[model samples]
Target: MIPIDFKGKRLVLFGAGRVARLMFSRFPELNVVAFADNDSAKHGTFVGKVPVVQPEALRHLEYDLVVISTGWWESITAQLQALGVAPSRIVLPPKNMLAINNGEKPFSHAPTKALALEVLGCVADFSARHAIPIMLDFGTLLGAVRDGDLIPWDDDIDFSLNDHAYPLFVNHLADLKVALPKPAGCDLDMTVLEAEDLITGVAVTYRNAVGCNAIVPFEIGFMRRVIENGQSVTKGAGPSFIAPEVHFHNVGSITFLGKQFCTPDDALGYLSYVYGDWKTPRQDVTLAEYPMQESEYLETSRTLV
Candidate 1:
């Protein structure tokens, strides 16, 4: 979808986390009058030039609407109502409206175990052919580290590349796929997504035998910060890290689908750093996993062929 244009509309984003930053950049027409957050300490701070105010400030501020970007939108909406912003003035972002840099689609489905492995092999081979290294991330990492294979309940694949290697691969994704010595039998499509010259996300997608859209998604970012007990996660900073750079500083290999794939040295700690309940399997998954998003510093969107 084309990036939304909310020009001239004054907007007050409720949460100042990962999703909020995506909203901030998705709408170029939006005249973000102010940002509201419960974090009083951050009130005087700025999300770019726009100031973040205490939620209560919405009572007296003149704006068009209060955009609730947090997961707890119900509570935030009621809070905004009590703060005197009209109920109709509050809204949740349209479905799949979140900003994405990875080559991802608004919708995706899982693949068969064989297809999943093939995708992984394709990525590894492609990376090796070009001399670019890739790291397993998110559920894909969990599967390798936890079960040494893709999670049965999982539907896609994930990997990470340092900011530098990501674009190099994305720019040549299609050509590389076409050049694979013996490509996977599945139909393949790949893309590189960008906003304002920064790579956001990339995906190698294919249709499995079951007619499911299997995606091997990659995000470009650094694991920059630490989390606390999984209660508070840095939002809107862009996740797009399986672990911090230091953890990935030492890399090792794990047998995934009978092939050696790279993983972080402190695999358990890296898992803990991202998903706290790493030991227990949470089979229930959605596109909305990885709660934080990197702040979009600019609003330009482009695609590389």
Candidate 2:
């Protein structure tokens, strides 16, 4: 998941905090030779039997990679670079790990869980009122099923609507804006942007009263069922690979933020098809980077639908 092949490679974990301990525990295959920390008190300590040394020790030690386990990666990276450590050998932890456990705050300074739940609730209510079928998609769906909440590092929520529901929901954009709540001391707004070949949905944003532009945007993707090479597949707006139509045929519910929301009928299977290892949290790549061959969909063609 860290994107590095650990086989026969020596590793030095920088920062002897919880993040370092977690990395050591999770990766049994890592040849962690030592831990480098800046704190003087931790210089002589041990993290899971691996001795901790000062950052200066790195110059004398031989290792293949130096994993920056702390959330303060920018400063640590600069420190490592000053110490003459190769940028190629330094690795940062996944965004999920940093946001969930490393004291990294979510965007807009809003409470991550509370804001995400509020936005999701609004969307759910609107869908129900309009009788428009919608389902969680991409990272939003993965976070709901895997983490039981929005991924703290995620900037927005993702929802999917079929071609039929897309236009209907777009037509009732005014109703959705009315439904969006303007909590006291906050300003909320929504707008729809159009592309060359498709109509993109609106993004719900929240701005605080103190002139802080803390926005939690949510997007609805328009997906259509079409035949590709005699096989039924699902295609979304913009250039994207076709997915198996079966995954989007029905909707199911999952408990997210202590409330039930719709998801693809086979949530687990759908994730597996999109993200090869849905259980692992990754920040190095996104859904857009995933190739069609990596999924259960049509493998012969990588053509964008």
Candidate 3:
């Protein structure tokens, strides 16, 4: 066990990569003061929508804890020490927790599939209680039905509700508490964006930006199309699995994060329509567009018969 706990500490994360982004989802209690990276290109960048600064910039800011969010945690710790950051102020995720995924060259926390699923469930509970209908949207939806988990490099959770139900959430949902369980299997919590609006729909970010802990992500969307889909796509009270991709499964459940949540009628087909190459992970890169791949049902049928 890494003896995880971040109470009464204001943190400054070094390296604005996947690890830094995931720190939030894994340890929501952590009070991150700011983010610092050595990359000159990322100096003026933002991780988790938080600004990134150079080492020298640390002198002007205030923080109590420093975490090295990179595979080179060892060297970064020493560098921070040389820069006068106290050893006690520095923290490192357990060595056992550091892991690599696919062809990615970063050492982040092992994938926590459960943590992501639990948060999804919590939102479902919230929606049901408030009578607000919400469905997984965009990358989050694609990853769930396709890979059965969040996309590695993709940071954030996404959801789209029917335009009519949008007001139900807006009028209700005092807040979004990310459902993070205790035990090492997974950790989840909740954090609604400050000052949520109505029309924009609330953007909920559940993925913590790494492998297990999740990617730095924001969950936002709603049904009803705008000119993107050939000007014919307009928002409406949809039955789902109609426009994006045909979800033959019909609205039902799929196991994710150790629990079952409702998915499109044809969750698998919907994924195929959006992301053609759904099996292989895309970590910090893009691939040339290709034809739509077969959905889970089609692939499974081939295996069965």
Candidate 4:
């Protein structure tokens, strides 16, 4: 079920692509006032009976929330922010659109889980062979420790690499790509490595060779140990808080999917810091809604990867 309360609320879907059409068909009760697209070609088009207009049209539309209905939601989020849309008024897509249930524990997308595990196994093997430290992070860690499997609603896998291992991983990207097993009519793509002040990460995707649909893409975040105010802290390239360095150090291993995977030394403590109540199942909550700790580093640095 969608986390948002759509009753009597107006909405603007920020794309006219396949996902937008799916949302329209699945939730006909939504009062979508317009479809906003960046593509000029779609400016005068129609998604079903809803008019597709320029993103600028959002200024004239009276809506309660803007639903980003495309895979490129990150960029669209920035666009919405530039247009002065409040963060609380933006709704991201659910973990798995097609598999969403009425707030129950939905089944994991079979193909997605299979493909993600395969990729994770290959990456883990490569990391072991090269002696580069990488640990299951974020939702992946939560799933591994709490459920002994991937979170049913999670769409991707996550791992974290320290400063030392990040350089090695980047240097051996080509070899890693070659080592990963590919699905039928698909090739592994490990070329995309992103590094920004706010976040540093790598994405592993599948490049379809034929008409094969793309599989799941996993992320690897780069975490750094920095000194602030005479104390050591751990900070990721993403929204992760500047946490005490002790929790992340001396990495340990745990069984995930029946295989040993690296994790934070004090995994439970780390989870507590990031998720106030890590044991409960709550699919409707977003990262922004998680409990926050005061960080002297950045005013907004209280969430997780």
Assess candidate 1 and give its lDDT.
0.59
TM-score of 2: 0.53
Q: Pull out the clashing pairs in model 2.
A: none
Query: lDDT at 305 for candidate 4?
Result: 14
TM-score each candidate: 0.53, 0.53, 0.41, 0.63
Candidates' lDDT values, in order?
Answer: 0.59, 0.65, 0.51, 0.65
Q: Report the backbone clash tally of model 2.
A: 0
Specify the highest-TM-score model's number.
Answer: 4
Number of backbone-clashing residue pairs for each candidate, in the order shown? 22, 0, 27, 2
Per-residue lDDT tens digits of candidate 4, residues 139-251? 78898889987787665566776655667766776778677776786555443433344334555555456666554333333344444553334453233334456765578
Model 1 regions lying over 4 Å from their true place: 1-111, 179-187, 207-242, 285-294, 297-304
lDDT tens digits by residue: candidate 1, 31-90? 788888887788898888898999978877888877777666656767877777787788
| Location of the lowest summed lDDT over 10 successive residues in candidate 1 | 217-226
lDDT of 2 by residue, 1-305 (tens): 33455458888988887657876775667789999998899988898789999999999998998887754566678899999999998876553332222223343345644665776887788777888877788788988889877776665566776555678877787887787666666666565544434554445555565765443333333343344553334442323444566765676778766656777778898888788899999754433344332222121211111
Alpha-carbon deviation at 204 in model 3, angstroms: 3.3
Predict model 4's lDDT versus the native.
0.65
Model 1 residue 77 CA deviation (Å) reads: 7.3
